[model samples]
Target: MSSQFLVTSRRDMEERGWDQLDFVYINGDAYVDHPSFAAAVIGRVLESRGYRVGIISQPDWHSAEPFKALGRPRLAALITAGNLDSMLNEKTAAKKFRSRDNYSPGGETGRRPERATIVYANRMREAYKDVPIIIGGIEASLRRFAHYDYWSNKVRHSILLDSKADILSYGMGERSVAEIADALAEGKTTAEMYDIRGICYVTSRAPLSDKAVMCPSYEEVRDDKKAFAEAFKIQYEEQDPYHGRTIIQPSENRFVVQTPPALPLTTEEMDAIYELPFQRRWHPMYDEAGGVPALQEVQFSLTSQRGCFGHCHFCAITSHQGRIIQHRSHESLLREAKRMTELPDFKGYIHDVGGPTANFRHEACGKQRISGACRNRHCIGSEVCPNLDTSHEDYRRLLREIRQVPGVKKVFVRSGLRYDYVLADHNKKFVEELCQYHVSGQLKVAPEHVVKHVTDLMGKADAQAFLKFKEWFDEANRKLGKKQYLVPYFMSSHPGCTLRDAVELAEFLRDMHMQPEQVQDFIPTPGSLSTAMYYTGMNPLTGEKVYVARRPEEKQMQRALMQYKNPANYDIVYKALCQAGRRDLIGFGPKCLIPPRRLKGTRPEQTPQRRGSLQLPKKTRRRDTRGRK
Candidate 1:
């Protein structure tokens, strides 16, 4: 309530040692790690039950220093979230681009720690073998099964077993973290805590054999890395919950992990979660290197809601968060907004709010409450429950409230908004408001592909809907007397796209007179429905045959479609046309506007006699020029 935890000083921890610590929380990634905030919340929860607590932020879990720093105390347990290190490459030009103005005098330097949450857990295990290490967050939640790793380009098992954490909390952490802390403080042992929902833990006999007791097979998740990464990118771009079975296993050697039921938060609960104290500063390291750039300013972010009803095949939100829409209260959002406004040299705007699908206010229809997402693994042919509502009213209201907060001036919906939902609204007032107020002349919307077959395969909205939405968006901006432009996000080389599809898309771009600023190659992220199609060429849900373009040439064509303006793409486009047997498109296709080349003369025509005869042409030319002069 005080927001004092927003600024964690070393002295605060020094004053509160092992005796004051009811639980020691750990973070896998520094970006998501908010020791000060976690400590304050867990400590408050513990204190509510008459126990004291302290927090340790990104401590050297590998060394005994952290353990010694706290000394020997009534150590209740160790809590952790998904990230151990920032998954972003600190040395990347992307990072530099994101923080151009914030560039330090020395330029951006310093290596980010390994981002795998399990890495930090393993280090913690090394120091405190018997201590309970509870893991949660995106890294732990999504990886709680056999998953494909983009960084390593291989399938791996759940972080729980890999890191040897006592328990793995999946999905949203607020309730689960509190429950786990309360259970541990009551003297429940690690083995006894398995009964808690949204957690994954090993049985006592887990390590006795090489096999996992409850693991899914590794063959299930032996997906291709490229497909996995592409699907993952789509999920992030769409921000719609994907509705298909994820690869839960890779090989017989390792078992795949599945999550417990998704817990949808009510507005009240969402309010309480956001109200938790968050460290509202750019990460110290990031700041020291020069503050984060405007684009990368959201190095630390929090979502105000979860679950999406939009059943996009390329998204994992529905699978991970369910089709139910949950939200935090307006009061809670304002509180966080105020905290963000209070940062040192803080500007008025916060990065983003909302989750899964930003515009999703509730389930599609009117199902108030229901069981967690049906873990059916596929939604290809399944009927969408009528109760789910994909309306934008609630979000519109939330955004309106967020914008009016005292210190906040601009509230960007950096999260993906379901364009279908926005377009379906009978009135265009909301769209106009978004254009005039929230957007900064550039609004990002995902129209993953122009190919109808592929969009159907990926469970995305048809291209027509995107076009209609584009029209309405433009109209809305015009009505509001604004010059905002739509930056449509497109994906190339998805699971079921072919060279023809890519070519058609290229033609569409040419017709629209639009060129994309960024093009994302499909990378299959682990644990999503789309990944299965990318890997097996079959939809996991319906077992239906799906076309996948995997050849190097096909991939090149799809990629070239997004870069029509680049000269390098000329050869690529040519080869694509040739390979697709569209030789007519070689010189100047409908989409490609290059000029044709002249034909060459045969060798016989260039002999000495032919040359002498042709010499007359030169004499005629000279005579004509002399006469004219």
Candidate 2:
């Protein structure tokens, strides 16, 4: 088969001699035929299964004309809100319109409509009435159940009902989409797909499955915070594939049924998906608009794995990809590297070679493959589990093999690396290899915070583990005669973080001589555990009260504390110090975070230890001068 992009227009379809499409995949992002993009992955997956897939990227949702570009698909209309949630893509954390969208042509903003899945699905319905519509991707996946919308600042029903989509395929849809396509090929209706795994559907009178667990109804969660917390806890717990159960939630007169996640693809299965004929770049139609900027970061990258076992509360990987790690085979990855070298744009650099968590190539523990992750326990948290196989030998070897590829000069791991897990490994070879080869002068790791109390709430591992990793990282660079540094990522204003905690974190930064280029304030995006805590002021897992900086001023102070050295944050830092009873940090002392303003001076100045001690004791000064002479 030709390694060309799937049909995007009628001309392309006509060229391929296709009378009708097997699936018309609508996406909120620009057409990028790379594997990293979900639309590309699903379209290619269907094509690989002998289905003629047509892509409608970033359609004009204001009318149905754009949806008619590919005529009508024979089987289903697959829709997704791109790789990111459309609301997040179009707006900032402050709910202001973003100026640029990397997913669009030339990074233009507002190219796609907000609430893209619903808008696109509605448009598809208008263009091809009676066509079965299937919604998936991050937006539909995260909001598969009743979810809180940060932009709207209210709880909303499942996207299925809003989009009028026939079926909702959550998580990685390669497996689910294939099954759905095969079933549709066999002349099955959307109603029969209700029993499919990793899918969701709505019904007015149909009863939920016996094995399903029901969440707090939309009315209950919307009216009661405690009920929302309880509902989110159950949803979080039942995400594991091994022990997860179908979940159902009700809104008004209908019920939304979400089946358990699809089982992870085996290594061979994963390799086959990646090995599919992908153009590996955005469509040529985008060339005039400077191509897709999103492709720059991933055009040369090789995805070695999928899924993450490090279930951070702020991350949606657990809710989307699940905690099970599905890695590609070494042969598969090496072949990709070789193929990348053949591209005309190839310059002998492979940008990245990892997934959600870089070093995770295998399951967390042996038990996970059989019994699944423990319902209530973390794989590597305050302490690494005894069964946690923190080995990097395979990862190290894989890197070596890729480095040996004929035209590959460098391979970097830019994704999140669990330093705590790296610390657990006694074999220091991976750390040394990382410092010596993979690092691009700085390795970004999310310690998130230095304080144990704050990190615990963030689902980060022990604070001491980060310190240990820092020590080993420094030692490795010293032995290797390299000057690479660890750029630790920290989050401020997270739940359970107080002003005092922010001050403590600032002091830690001072001690480390690190001034972060950027600090993230906790964003309560929907569906994550952190958002649950932000909304309810309680940790859903434990039902314990959490200290959330809800006030705008308080949140600003916490964020300002992270960048305390910035001139713009001086006032907020000063106010925060005073509020925390940390006046000692406000003086002109060497360790002070901010200098004090002289009562009558035009600008702030250094102050003596005491009011009358400005002269520095003439006798002591003379004695010091005499010693110097």
Candidate 3:
């Protein structure tokens, strides 16, 4: 099936004898097929204002044919947004690695899109140089600054200048997209729309015209790559909405795009986005052709909420969704669950259901609508703002309602739950409910690191908090008499982690008798605050000196500490100790697993003689002088 983007510069131009349109919205991948949803939302909002609009989803956006497919209309203005590309790239482990020798017939290689969202914007520039192209979504929003790319292993700057988009919107696109559509429809120039919240555009002339916008200097963020990488690594490993940090806005010109008031969608509006007749399989085309193996057949995913309250130093959710949580109604969630149960190959387990933070319900502490933009990105960081409310009463109701859904024999909170939020709540009922109903034998939570200093740097819960939560969880499980186990997630070699810190973690693990199977090395993703710290040894926001474990040896030691018993780790630990010149830890120091002599080698005198006769040892044993005298 061919997909096309619907765009026109003129209102009713197609109806008024125009043959084609001047603009087209391009997308990067097929999986994140939400351009259509955004388009539908924008179309509905515009129609409410008596403006004509059409929506389209161009899956293979690289192909120029889609631009022509949507019958051309007299041009007015081009508006592009939300999803520009699949943010998941080769560097993100989205693709399986295959060797050339292992290549087989009909096997696809290099499935990644050739052009990034910025590259697509550049292509659009080539096709329609004068047309307005707005870029948004994870790609454009995050990369609107100079940052490092793990795939190319190099530094990059604002995607707007690179992709050649006229303007870049930096957050959720519904409200912004609607405003842009209306403004353009009303004949407002692109320059007039500059002040819109969440939009980033380059000025035709500026004192710093060469730069896209006045953002934090690359030098400020350059040395912070390791820190940022570590932060991103923690986010991916935990997938816990509560455990992330505020990813810094790259540009001073870039203020966060705030989410509109939770437009409590009726069940019908919820159905519109979810009930769209589209392929839900992991790979729709591959499945139909029987190319997907049986192992790939069963896959599950769904979104329950749209925003988060717990913002860590390394997260972008607050910037994207705002601190206020927007939840899909319990009835809507139940309907989605029912739909999942009716799937042709439905298994009893629903893979996961969640949004930015799983347990977040749209309800706030009081009925008052919180106003004013958030100065800080995360609400639940070191200091909770007076305006912030961390209640979960409504979330509890949602979970209870979801559990009662028909045909859903079991539900799994596979994404993640904010253990800190659960622990902080006035009641322990949610924890009890989770233990008894939601968990599928294992409950995953991210206590990123055991070191307090490192956890503080990462804006995560300290050891004390994690320990308390663990104790509560254990007790809850025992009380329920359930077989569920808590799978605590951890990160290694984050910014602020030193060899000594790693050793401390090793000691902590040994004391707890916890053996971890997964240990993640920090990978710097583009456009994160921690990535800047990881690359540079200073905080991008504060410019304060921060510790970073960049050396391979230091990183190895940190990883080894997580897996002390693995023989591979023993080699890593020994090598790291030798590199650090801390020979004391090579053998069993308080933290070492290998004995000291085992690492330093035995003395000749310590070796046993083959025969009973004294073969003068390299160093003769001391004689009993008093007895001899």
* Model 1 TM-score, 2 decimals: 0.76
lDDT of 3 by residue, 115-188 (tens): 35655566555555566677766666666655576555566655765676666766555556666766776778
The CA lDDT of each predicted structure is: 0.54, 0.83, 0.53
Off by over 4 Å in 2: 206-210, 598-629
lDDT of 1 by residue, 1-629 (tens): 44344212345556554234555555332332232233334444554555554444455545556643553335444545322113322322112222311212223323224444666676666666667777765556666665655456466665767777777766655567777777876888866765455566654233322221232344433545444444333333222223322222233444333324435667776665455444544345445545433224343344676666566765555434556667666667666776667666557776667665567656555423543344442222123343334456677787888788787778887566767666556547888778877786566666778888887776777778778877788788778887666666677888888888888877776666665544666655545666567766676555567788766667768887665555546667767767766666556456453334323331212211111001101111110000100
Order of quality (lDDT): 2, 1, 3
What's the C-alpha lDDT at position 71 in model 1?
A: 38
- What is every candidate's alpha-carbon RMSD to the true fold? 13.4, 9.1, 13.3
- The better-scoring model by lDDT among 1 and 2 is 2
Residue-level lDDT for 2 in candidate 2: 59
lDDT of 2 by residue, 558-609 (tens): 8788767766678888899999999999877878887785233243223311
Cα TM-score per model: 0.76, 0.94, 0.72
**lDDT winner among the candidates?**
2
